[model samples]
Target chain A: MARRGDELMEFSGSISTLEELHALSLMVHEVASDWGISEKVLFEVSLIVEEFCSNSVKYGGIPVGVGIKLADSVITIMITDSGKPFDPTEVAVPDVTLPLEERKAGGLGIHFVNHFADTIVYSRENGRNILKIEKKI
Target chain B: MLINTSQKENLQIVSIEGRLDSLTAPELELWIRDNLASPEFDVVMDFSNLDYISSAGLRVMLNLSKAAARYSRKFSVCQAQDHIREVFEISGFDSFIPLCDSLDDVLAL
Candidate 1:
């Protein structure tokens, strides 16, 4: 984790185990609180971080890196994964308009990412999947 | 997370406090499996003090709601934050599971 003079706080690392997610969660909460983020935004950021990284840690078995930057009331989230090239934006979104009995479980996390984020961009560079999510505070 | 169970009138109220993420969601799920016997008592999940919930948490609640339907038990959620309610709405949980604004609202159902 690197803290600069600017409001941007950058953290990038690899975790071999799932326990690291909790540590990451604590770090996220502490940073958000230090920056005086709203409860709702912080919660959204937490969810976004968890869902993105969990897929890598639990499914892809690859190391994940996260970056959080705050500038002008806009929070930017960057996630880099060394796992098998996967694109969250391409995931088939479950029909949220469906009734309860017809609803399915898959893609809800990506659905959440889309709803909470103002914009999302996915790319692949040098065998890494980079996902950038931006949210307005 | 703090789960306090109590009886209110005839409904069994289960208040969940703190973050309900993957790390803590299973405890609540196991508690429900071990404690609540469906079809006998109506269930109310109070989220007044819950600060966070991820998809894992939502999955558990959906299981409870589905079980309620399977056994013909009344299950409702109360006191969710606006953002949380939005989550339920986005996931289509509000259609089958009632997201009440308050305990009184739940009682009225």
Candidate 2:
């Protein structure tokens, strides 16, 4: 867990465990609220968190971990999982024009994060898949 | 979220309200399992008042559609608000999940 500055909460992510996702999302909401983010921003953040965490569980391999960091006028989330080294950033965006039956669930989650986050980064290091997203308050 | 179901003729309508995120998606999953596992009937969902939907919701709906397809059952969505409709559109659910103008439309189909 990256508990350096303004730590909120830390939890372990095991296979089929969603408790950490819920707790981290709540913490993100609280930190965003504290930073005076708009209601619209909060809504968007909520959606983004749901998308990201869902992907981590549905796609990521093992042992997912989420960390929240609050700083001057910004809130950030770092999600690391030992999943099958998937870089969501690399996945092609899905064609929404396609009918639901034809369209696949490719970039829905990453697209939401990209649209909502002020900055997003994905990296694979030391056998860990790291996803960092930040939103300006 | 809790699902309450009622049937009229061959239409099995399930009305879902409240939040439908990851935490609650499982409950909906159970509801579908207990009620919709059989392939004998079509299914209609009334999400006119659902506040939130996440990827989990999408997964559940997708699985349901797959089950319906395997059993040759029809699936429809009725009375979704504009915002909810937007989600359906954004997630490309409008293609596979039939959207009826009203319950009558669903029942008629």
Candidate 3:
């Protein structure tokens, strides 16, 4: 388990399986609820975690660790994966204006992660991909 | 997730309860695909009891929408909770898919 401070609630797991994804979702929901976060903000945080964790598992093929810190009117999430050097923030945004026929779902997950998070930063260090995201409640 | 299906005229209504996340999204997609391949051409998914949705769930909906378009079938989603509807709006799914306020709205289409 990774911990930043006494106030931080952290969860870590292998991202190679769907079962872990399910567990991760449950854990995040529990922590968010325990912290008395609103349902709307919790849902957004859950969505961001799901998209990033699924992407890392399906595409990055590595283990992931997530740390969450809750503060008044602000929540910060840090996701670390030991996989390929990929930065989610650098992904291109999909064209939402395209007609249904021309639209492909390739980049929508990353797009949503970008849209919901108030601020996101990505970096690679020691062969690990670290993504930090912040949201305003 | 709990899925209940009922029929109103030619349309099949699927009411999904609980969260629709990465783990269960494939099941929903498969169910919709099976129905589309069968005699069922028109479908409406009711999300009144749905608590949450992630990108994976949204992808399943998009696939169903595209499949419906390809087969000349009718498909729409109704009764989405405010949070779920916000997800749809941010993803821009509301533009391509028919989102109804109620089951009756979809039935009327």
Candidate No. with top lDDT: 1
Instruction: Per model, state how many residue pairs clash.
Output: 0, 1, 0
Best by DockQ: 3
- Cα distance off (Å), candidate 2, residue B93: 1.5
Local distance difference test values of all predictions, in order: 0.82, 0.72, 0.81
Q: How many residue pairs clash in model 2?
A: 1
Give the CAPRI class of candidate 2: acceptable
Choose the strongest candidate by TM-score: 3
Which 10 successive residues of model 2 chain A have the least lDDT summed? A7-16
Candidate 3 residue runs with Cα over 4 Å from true position: A1-16
Candidates 2 and 3, the one with greater lDDT: 3
Per prediction, fnat is 0.42, 0.44, 0.70
Q: Which regions of candidate 2 fall more than 4 Å away from where they truly are?
A: A1-16, A23-40, A57-76, A81-85, A100-107, A115-119, A124-128, A134-137, B70-72, B81-83, B100-105
RMSD of each: 2.5, 5.0, 2.7
- Full candidate order by TM-score, most accurate first: 3, 1, 2
Q: For candidate 3, lDDT tens digit of each residue in B33-109?
A: 66655435587889999988887898888888888787787889999989998878877889977889987898788
Task: Give the winner by DockQ: 2 or 3.
Answer: 3
